[model samples]
Structure formats: structure tokens, C-alpha cells
Target: MAAENKKKEKTATCYQDCCAEVFNFYLGHSGEHEAILQCVHSVLPEEFKRIGAGKSSLDVLGVGSGGGQVDVQMLTLFQSTFPGVQITSDVVEGSIKLSNNFKALVGKTANLKNVPFQWHIMPSEDYVKQVKATEHVKKFDFIHMIQMIYYVDDLASTIEFYHGLLKENGRLMIIVETANGGWDTLWKTHSKDLCTHTITEYRSSAEIKACLDKMGLKYDEHPVPNTFDITNCFNPKDKFGCDLIDYLTAKEDFYASVTSEVKEAILDLLKNKCSSQKDGKIMFDSTLSCILVHA
Candidate 1:
């Protein structure tokens, strides 16, 4: 059943462009990623901390760097922590359109003086290939995969591949929206309205650990609560939330994969969910299952 479910999920199509556009808008204004980084880093004990460790130039890899919005927080953190030195940052994103937008975002932020980032615009599948060839072994100081695992075909294989990219003692940091948690529950409840795509395929801590054991990799999983309170971004008169309200109310045909009825259901659910919350709050409780691999 798991294998069949995984196959079904792999076949599911996402409204990637629409999702990215809406997500980027929220990211640009909400300071969401900064808060997430704070929570994400908390899950990792001293081992993930770069402080007091004699490491000069850090090499960091950020996967699914959508419009490079999250990089702002990451770059700012690196600069404040390690001054007067450039951290070689590599952004792995597949879309040329998104890559262009990312470049623009970087230019606006002055390209991070202490952190120079290069875009590796390759599909995640191809990236998996590099890992298989041992070409990506231990290449990054910190490897990040945030809200990206859902799009991949194989969770265990993808996790293993990213783990392979880490050097000895390197940290593979992940910030995944717990697919079966409150956030996902809400998203699923609104499936007929707001969700453009979804898959029940997920890895609990035990499941991921078992996969790691099979591959001879040891890892520690920490559960952290990830919250998004976007109340300020909403306007009562607006359709969905605020500036990107259209995204929330995007037409059914915008995501051709899903039936028109399913799309409408999702939008209605979004409205109802928002209505139920106090102060018209649009919150996503993205409980994170932070996995730390001792690569």
C-alpha cells in the first residue's frame, strides 16, 4: 500500500508557479522565514551551531530557493555570525523563471557581501543523479530542504541523497510541513477550495529512522511546532487574504489536474477555515519534523 501510495503521489501534479507566486509574496513581507529559521535552528543542538567552531568560509546549499526570499534571512544570519568572510552559497532550483526572479531578489538585497550565492538551476531528479555518482558527497556545510520533499517521488531516496551531499560531520537541515498534522488537516479539509495538490505520502520519525538504518545512516529527529500567523496580511474586503488574494481564489482551470468541483471545495474550505479563526486569522501550523543526520 505504501509503494502504491507513493506512486500515486509521484503522479500528482502541483500548481507550482501559482504556489510559488503566492508563497513568495508572503515570504517577502511577513518575515516568516526569519521566524522559521529561529525555530528550525532551535531543533538542532550545538552540533548544528556554527559558533565557536573554527570554520571560516562556510558552504551552504539551499534547495527549492523560490525567488530566493528565504536567502535574505539565511544570508543575514551568516553575515552577522561570521563577519568579513564570504560564505559560498549555492541555490538549487529548477525553474529558469524562478531563477531569474531569484537573481533580481539578490540584486535588490545587494547580493549579500559576506555570502555569495550561485544558482544551480537543475531539477531535483538530476540532483539525485549527482548524489548517486558520489559527485555531491560532503559538498555543503549546511544543506537545507524546506517544504520541498512533497514534490519529490521518493522520500527515503531523496533524504538519502541529500544526506549523501553532506560531508563528514555536515548537517542536513530540513524544515518540512508535517503533512499529517494540523496544517495538513486544514489543507485537506479545504481540498475542494484552496489546495492545488496534495499527497498523503509522508515519513514519520520512526519511518525515516528505519530508512536511515537501511542505508547505514544515523539520524536524530526533533519535532518542532512551526506556526504562521498572517493576520496582518489580510484585509476584510479582500477575496482571499491580502495582496495575493487571487491566488487563494484562483480559478479551477488554473490547476487543470483537479476537478472543478474539487477546486471549488478547496476554496470554500479556505473561506470557512479563515472565518472560524479569531480576527480572521490565516494560520498554518506547519509542525516541523526536523531531521538531523550525522553525515
Candidate 2:
């Protein structure tokens, strides 16, 4: 990003502007969602083995469940693990468009027809505030914060608050890019210009491990391997290419705003080191890690 723009207050990354583009990128680039699902599935079976031992229904909370794609996958996993058990899912998302899209998806999916879903169109902070003010004691069997904790102000406090909401043996799951991933590398390199409070700044599995350790919390971590094809990004002038770059960097059209030197430097790293050519395809590592903490 440009130095002048960086000097000014950074704007919040708006999902409404680029949600479709992001989903399309995910669909085209890599099997990130599936990889994440696999990692989560690997960890949950053991941690949640007691979920339906006697109970018939599960209470689930999905924080920042954009479009409900992953939320549906997790809920489906729960159902498959405990057959015939109903689930009441409370989806927390700030985007109206994405929430509506999720509802539409639920309406069309045959398996999800029986599941009851509640939509809370607000940020996690607001939801926490409301719960605290109302003295609501509703507890959940599972809570998933899928790549959403970066938007939170205080990670430790937020985890504590949600951790308290979990029933006995309940699991609080979190997913984030690994420290060695390109996303973390980009943030570590360009935090002064690109990083902001609204965007996820310090949210890698390694960092989260430190937080959990400091909080005296015990958890399990799983590493997921994934890759993204970014040959289109070799062209800096193309609008779609620039938009993809912005999406990857979590900035609004970052390539368009940066100087030629800055753009060239970033692109050079992406082409030369961050990504590798295989079968004439430039693939960038997009690995992620999932952590599960007990209540």
C-alpha cells in the first residue's frame, strides 16, 4: 500500500464489497475449505465423543459464519457422528448479504431442512454485550470461530468469555493460517502499511498457541496443507489480478494503491519465493492450522 494512504487511518476490510470475489477465489484457487474441514473433523471426533452419549440435541454457535458454508459442513459432521440427533445452530455474522445467502442455502439443501438455525446479524462483541446485559445463561455444546477472531479487540478476553459459555466437555474451535503461511508472511512484512485493527493482524496458530499457553489453557492443534494458484497475479495491470492480490492481502485493491516499487517488490517475492512453479502453474502455499480447546 502507498505510504500516504498508510499514514491515514486504515479502513475496515468490508466483506460486503468483496464477499463474492472471495468465495469465487476459494472455489477456483484451492481446497482450503475442505482441508480445514478435514483438520477440524480429525480433532472433533475424540473431543466431542461424549456429545450425544445421552443428550438428543446439540447447541452450536458459529462465530462469523460467512455464507454458512463451513457452518453447514461442521453441523453435518456432527449429525453424521451422532445419527438421528437434531441440532440447534446459532449463526453469528455481521454481513446481511452473507447471512441471507446462508439462509437461502439452508432452504435448498435437503439434509439441512430439519436443522433449526438462528441468525444473529451482529458482531461478536455486540452478541457478548447483549448476553452479559440480559444475564443470559444459555450454554452451548460447540463453538467455532472460523478465521474470525482477528476482528476481535482482545483475543484472550474474547476466548475467556466464549469459553465460559461452553458446557462441560464442550469444545471451542479456532482456525487460522500457520505462521509460515504466505498470509502471515505478508502481515509480518507489511504490517505498518497494511495491518489494521479491523483486519486480522496477529492471528496465526503459533501466536494463538502462545495466547492459550499464557492463559493456562489446554488444547489440541492440527495442521492442514493447502495451496493456491496465483499465475494470474503475475500480471499487475489486470483488474482481476489486482483484485485477487488485494483479496489475498486483505486490503482494498492494494496493488492499485501501492507504488510501482512496492508492487514490484511484493510481486517479485510472490513469483520467486512465496510461490513455486509446477507443471507451468504458479502455486502459493496456503496452509492453515486448527486448534481445539476444552471448556
Candidate 3:
């Protein structure tokens, strides 16, 4: 009877309606972009040299590239690494708003002029299907999926499809949260109660590594340490805090939608289990792992 009551309890609502706004806020506070840039600059140059070796041109693919900020920087680095090589970049992004933002960024960025970009405004699955249906598809020398692996339906097939699309000496880069990261811990513990999104899966680097291992794919991993202030999350009156909670759970108005007990449980877990105190503020474990595969 107790279990039945628990099963019937109200969970959090999905936050798809305002996901962009919430996500932007989270990005601003998280310092994620800087950390990703650092990781990319540190690890990718040598890998780029390997991929661009003996080639006068390179094909690049960016999956789920949000707003094109990181994509532009990475492509710029690639161009610098192989100044004589011609680069073609293909971007697959599902969100219209983000796609527009990416286009606008590209327009203003003068460095990207030499590299032609083919924008595909669709989900990765759709893009994959379209490519598979085409008689002859372009193979990519460099492909990257940054912080967007959770949106894919089948991890194994997704990895396989992208890996199959790589040219000789090609590289595929994936960035996702670490297994013991705060987001991972939160979702692992309370996904049944808080995660109501049908599309987004709770995945981490550990899960991706497991899928690769199952497929007999070899890869290298690098840790990217990141954190964000979560002191506002404990303050019920802070709107940013409320939005952060919603984003964290991928839910809409999470604090108000869930049962009081569930809400309290999530808060306790966030404070005590998912974060640590630093400089008088609660810091979230936003640490991510970068995985690189050669094809």
C-alpha cells in the first residue's frame, strides 16, 4: 500500500517550454564554456595534427552544437593547425532558436569565412537518417558531440553510426558529465521522482565508456573540472535558484510541481549529496569528461 501511494505521487513537470532560457542561465553561471575551451585547446591540437596529416582538406561535423560559440573556436583552431587545408563544417542542431543564434554568430565571426558551413536544422537522428538515405554521403575527418549525448535515443547505434561516418585517421570527440559528477549523482538517485522528460536520458561518461566497451571501440578520456554556484538554490525566494532547480531536473517549476516530501528530498540531496561548500557558497560538481575515439 505504501509503495502504491508512492507510485501515485506527483513528480516534476518537464521544462521543455522554457528550456532555452533556463539553459542559457545555467551556462552563464556554470563557467562551462571556458572549461570546455581549455580542454579543447589542451587536447585537440595534437589530435588535429594527426587527422590533418597528409591531407589538403578536411571535413568536420558538429552534432547538437548549441549557438556555435565553441564550434567557431574549435574550427578556428583546426584552421590554424593546418593553415593550408580547406575545411568544410556541417552542423546538425535541432533547436531553431539555437540554430539562428549559431548563424548570427557565424556571420559576425570573420575567421570562419574560409570554412564553409552547411547547417542542418534537425535532430541528430533525422540527420543520420537523411545521410543514410543519400546515395553518397560525405565522410568527416573530425566530428564532435559536446555535452549533448544524452539527447540521443540509442547510444550504441549513435556511436556506431558516427564512427562509421569517419574517414581514415578520423577522430570523434564526445564531452559528457563524469560518472560521479553532481548531475549524475542527482539523476541516479532521484530520476524516478524528478525526471519526467521523455527524450533526455540520464547519461554520463561512464555510460558512454560502457557502450564503447561493448562495441569493442578504443578511446581516450580526459577530465575537465568545472563548478557552479548553487547558493541561490537553497533560497526559495530566489527566482534564479528556482529556475536552476528546474533545469537541474529538466522539469518545469520543479519546486512547485513535486510533492512537498519529494521537493524536500531533492533539495536535501542537492545540498548534501550533489554539492560541496566553497567560499561560503554551495558549489555544484559540474565536472565533465572528454572522450576521444579514432577511426
- Over 216-285, each residue of candidate 2 has an lDDT whose tens digit, in order, gives 9888888888887888877767777766787776666776677878777777777776677888988887
RMSD vs true structure, all candidates: 6.2, 3.9, 5.2
* lDDT at position 4, candidate 2: 57
Q: Stretches of candidate 1 above 4 Å error?
A: 1-19, 25-34, 40-52, 84-86, 114-116, 130-138, 186-238, 241-276, 279-284
Candidates 1 and 2 compared: the better one by TM-score is: 2
Clashes counted in candidate 2 amount to 0
Instruction: Name the 10 consecutive residues with the lowest summed lDDT in model 1.
Output: 245-254
Candidate number that wins on lDDT, 1 or 3: 3
Q: Give the backbone clash total of model 1.
A: 9
lDDT of 1 by residue, 29-113 (tens): 5455765667655653365454215776678788877666666666666666666655788887866777788788777776474
Candidate-wise lDDT, in order:
0.60, 0.77, 0.85
Error of 2 at 161 (Å): 1.1
Point to the candidate with the largest TM-score: 3
Candidate 1 Cα deviation (angstroms), residue 207: 5.8
True lDDT of residue 58, candidate 1: 72
Pairwise TM-score winner, candidates 2 and 3: 3
